[model samples]
Target chain A: MRQTILSISNLSKTFGGVVATDDLSLDVEQGELHAIIGPNGAGKTTLIAQLSGEIFPDNGRILFQNKNITMLPPFKRSHLGIARSFQITSLMQGMDVIDNVALATQANDGHAYKFWKPARDDRDLRQSAIDALKEVGLEGREFEKVQNLSHGEHRQLEIAMALATQPHLLLLDEPMAGMGTEEGDKILKILQKLKKRKTILLIEHDMDVVFALADRITVLVYGRAIASGSPQSIKTDERVREAYLGTEGDLNC
Target chain B: MRNLLTRKSFNFAFIISVGLLALLPLYVEMTGDDFYLDLANRLMILAIAAVSLNLILGHGGMISFGHAAYLGIGAYSVGIPAYYEIYDGLFQIITAVFVSGVFALLTGAVSLRTKGVYFIMITMAFTQMAFFGIVSIEEYGGDDGLVIDTRSTFGNFFDLEDTVTLYYFVFVSLLISLFIVKRIMESRFGMVISGSKSNERRMQSIGYNTYRYKLVCYVLSGCLCGYAGALLGNFTNFISPEMMDWTASGELIFMVLLGGSGALLGPLWGAASFVLLEEWLSSITTYWHFFFGALLILVVLFARGGIDGLLSKIGLSK
Candidate 1:
């Protein structure tokens, strides 16, 4: 009898003649790692965008902690404890690694209208950023500029920023998209550790990671959810196999 | 590769420049050339205006082409009162800041909704509107401009009419403005503004209401520039509609770009070089503008970071 943390009811969005999110409905329970998988052009990014308030659904409602948040802007949703990591690693590239994480922590703490004290001198904020970076295994690279970080490190930093916000639910969009096997393993370990503490909605393209990490799996096909079940059931489900898993090659791994 | 010089060296250069400016009046007096005092005053006033512009343009990534409108509003705030013989320095400065702040709030509310080229064009249009409005006011000398009978008075504490007193006053004000702007840039509020400039969509995703922060920055920049306008009106003892012309706004942008947009002392360096070039070139030829324009083009082409950037290149990599 797990409690539902996020409930998307009949969400629909379209771009011109293309239906990007076609009457999609799904529920994620507290502390459960729910993964969304689909082929290219299956509107996986579009679904994440709607949940994070980047794009609005033409019809339907989104509920977080039993409160409707369909129309709330991204910042409001973030304040309500929904944090997201981007698929493309959207960070302040010119800033230092610690400062980037500190900004995320600062956003929810209080009003940022205080114009006198330097943020760099705020020990609490800096410590919080350091702790988040430590969690992501980026301890000694605090002052390094984000532009100089490796692709794997950027992905790790992305997750660190999301975690620094102290979110109740994490919406991770391809957290290991463009990484080598070593980098991917590092993120997997981090995600595995995070799974014990937070409710995670993961969007991943790698079948092995999805099968290993996801408690429940939802397969999307052309903006519609075609199957929803436990990873064991989804692996065996004939419709999911034909719609997506088949084209992704053998799901045996 | 390691940098040739560190940030410490850049800072040393900044301190030396400020020190030179502080002792400029003594140098002018010793050289028996009182005209340098006037040039120094003009440079400091414009430097204040350029620093204000840098807050929005350099830090916030807002391109306002109508920033000169605030300057005009500030000057008229002083001129209109002086027309009635008020001649109070505090009142003139207060009104100038207030008027410019309100105008920025209103215009920024609308202009901030648009981005890129639209923001520039809308700001330009707003400045032109302010220019025309001032031009049609016959009581304040209309397009012909107005002259103050007496400089603003600060009671027995200070006299604006005394050239030496005025020089010290402007010099102190410039330093204060620089300190305030630099402090704001280092604050938590500054992080959000700079973050927005870097990636606005990412900022929103991270839970920042960027619009509100940007508007506040806009108003604050306008207020500072308006103060500079008030000082300029006192310096020249005249206020005119031409002060807020679009070309004047362009010159301010050039100053920011020429010095270094985001650097603290870049605008000051830009203002000094621009004014000195104008004076030196105009003495040689009447068509000095052509040469100035060429210099600006060269700066834009070769010196992407302006003078401050060039200085940084010689020292730190940043």
Candidate 2:
């Protein structure tokens, strides 16, 4: 049996009167691509936020490698090898692409208190950033400003930055949220390659990509998990079909 | 090469300006006008303060409205010593830096906890507190302010009393400060600070403890400004609560914005233009502030990047 890398027990969060996440529990095994699917307002983002420490759950425990990390801040969680890509493409827009990724590499490599030598001159850091970019198929676009990149490229850069941190588990929120079929295919190929080496917890709206990539799927509806099973089982699960896939329409395409 | 020069003209403009400052003493001597020398000295000293403010206000995106408090602290570090008949230049300098650094550490620790408009208000409140505290010190001239009997002595190694010598000293100090600020901004520490400014949430999520980085920057900026305060106190031969007034802090912010905010030499240009405009306008009429205010409004409306931005437009600056 595969060892569990992440386990959530009794997770709960509420914003005002709205229940964003409710008494949710799930397990993600090492080296498995776990996909969390839900309808709009299903708290998929909220669950990712709590897991990444951006939002604290009202009540819950998050265990990573058997260590309780529910109370830790986002940076501490990042240090413990949890890197997240935002749904809104949270990148340093004014900075060059390479510098953005380089900063991520710098963040995890050592203490960022070095004040004498120029960071651009650090070959190891730059090389690691370049490698991350190369993995995302953005090798030649390093010097371009992030704001100038296409929306699809921004998503790729987001993944590159997350990858640059060398995290054990990648938390991607809507990586293909607004991508065209061509752009989606590019990202799908990159994720396919990544699945061979890295464990990713993805929140996706595209059923084709979800069914294609996910090893185990967790269906969420109104902040509560409806089912957790393999992709084939999740596709045909009576509750998942009624709650999410029934409304999604024509998943076989 | 031409394209490169145009693109990097800001650097060119900076070097030319510094070179002109270096030759101002010669111009003063040749024209038999010593008053210009004093004005130039004031410009360089204020430039130091402006440059320090830029580190937080421009680069770190922390709008601190009480930066002049460090200047006051720095000046008092020298003034309080001289009032006690202690005239050691090295001792005064050390005390000024240490006091200002500690002040920054303590104030930044508290003020940095609050952000946006609250940060500005909190910083202003701290400066006002310092100003009022200084005003209560009746022995140090209270509301009237204190006068230095003699310029700081450097163990007979140098004379700050000589105008030419003092000019060079302030000039070299400005160069050293620019070097230090530039180096820090290019380093890893600078990346974190700048990154935090761009997107603070992203920085935190990327495993950077942005608070510590920002606090360090605040303290560093404060200490540098405090050093400038020491120089200002010596140059004027006076230290006053007026130096730490909220208006004084506002002027420093204006200087940073009046020049391009993020550029290293932006504050230097801002200080020069501001002081020069003040001198020229005040010579023509008593209501110089009206014209200064109008000019500032115009700059804000048209040249959003300040003098540096305008120069860059004309292919004369970086």
Candidate 3:
């Protein structure tokens, strides 16, 4: 049996009287690409936020590597080998791509308060940031400002930044939100390549990408997990069909 | 080489300007213009204070409107010590830095919790509170302020009593501060700060405790401003509640904005130009503040990036 790296046991959250995430429990094994697919406003982003320590769940707990990380801040979770990429383009737009990723790398390293010594001169950090950029196929574009990059390139840079943290598990929210077919295919190919070495919990809207990438699929409907299974089982599940797919399943996917 | 110079052009300009300033007093003495030397010394003190403000407003992205409170604290540091006959120069400077840092910590803790305009308002409110508090201190000259009979001395090792020596002293202190600010801005922590300014939400997500980082920068900026306050007190032979006034705070902001807040040296230039303009305009008319205020308005509206921005536009910045 594959060992679980992240276990969300009965996690629940409520804002005022509305339930944002209701008694949701799921497990992601080590080295698996788990997909959480749902419609808009299905609490997909909120669930990812809770996992990455952006928000705290109202009930139950989250265990990472068998240790409770229920109350850790986003940065603390990042230090403990968990990294996340924002759904929106949240990079330092004025700075170069290499520098953006370097910010993440610098955080996990020793004290950043050392004055008089230039951060760029640190060979290890510079090389690692470059290497991570290369992994996302951004090798030739390291010096370019992030604001100048295309939407597709920005998405790639976001993934590259998360990769630079040298995360054991990557939490990506809406990686392919706004992309053309070619761009989507480019990211799909990259994620396909990365799946071999890293564990990923991806929240995606594209059914095709989710089905293609997810080793295990978890369906969330109105903040509740309706079904959990392999992509093949999920495609055939009646409850999932009624809740998410409905009559327009063939047209949408 | 041109790209490299442009990257740190503000610093290069600062060095050249300082070199010119060092030779200025000699030219003034030759021409029998002692008044220009006095003006130079005054500008130097304001430059020192503005440079400190740049650390927070420019580099740290914490737009504080109450930074002059530290200047008041620093000035009082010298006055209170001198009034009590504790006139050691080094000791007075040390006390000023400590008091300013403590004030920064207490005020920044409360103000930093809310961001944007709220932060500005909170800082302004605190500065007003300090201004009023000083006014109510009837023992220390109250609303009129206090004066020190003698400038501080370094335990008889050196005397800052001479005008020529003091001008050089203030100039050199500004130089040292420029170097320190430059060093701090290039470090790894500096990268995090710049990163936060560009995208704070991303920095927080990437594991940086931004609140702590901003607070450190705030305290460091305040301490540096206090050093300037110490020098100003000795130079003028007086300290006043006017140093903590809201207009004084606004002037600091204007200095940072006018010089091109993009680089540290810009604030120094901004301070010098502003003080010199005030001196020149006041000679022509007593209501010089109206013109200065109008100029600032123009800078904000048209020259959004300030003097450095204009210099860069004309291909002269580097």
- Relative to the unseen true structure, what is the C-alpha lDDT of residue A187 in candidate 2, on a scale of 0 to 100? 96
Model 2 lDDT per residue over B230-262, tens place: 999899899889999999999998888888788
Stretches of candidate 3 above 4 Å error?
B1-15
User: What tier of docking accuracy does candidate 2 attain?
Assistant: medium
> Which candidate number has the best DockQ?
3
Candidate 3 or 2, higher TM-score? 2
Candidates ranked, most accurate by TM-score first = 2, 1, 3
lDDT of 1 by residue, B215-257 (tens): 9999999999999999888888888999999999998998998
Q: In order, what DockQ does each candidate have?
A: 0.60, 0.62, 0.64
lDDT of each: 0.91, 0.91, 0.87
What's the lDDT for residue B188 in model 3? 84
Question: Chain A: TM-score in each candidate?
Answer: 0.97, 0.97, 0.96
- DockQ order, best first, reads 3, 2, 1
Which residue runs does candidate 1 get wrong by more than 4 Å?
Answer: A245-249, B1-10, B316-318
TM-score of each: 0.97, 0.97, 0.95
Give the poorly placed runs of model 2, Cα more than 4 Å off: A245-250, B1-10
lDDT per residue, candidate 2, A150-250, as tens digits? 99999999999999999999999999978999999999999999998999999999988999999999999999999999998986778887787675554
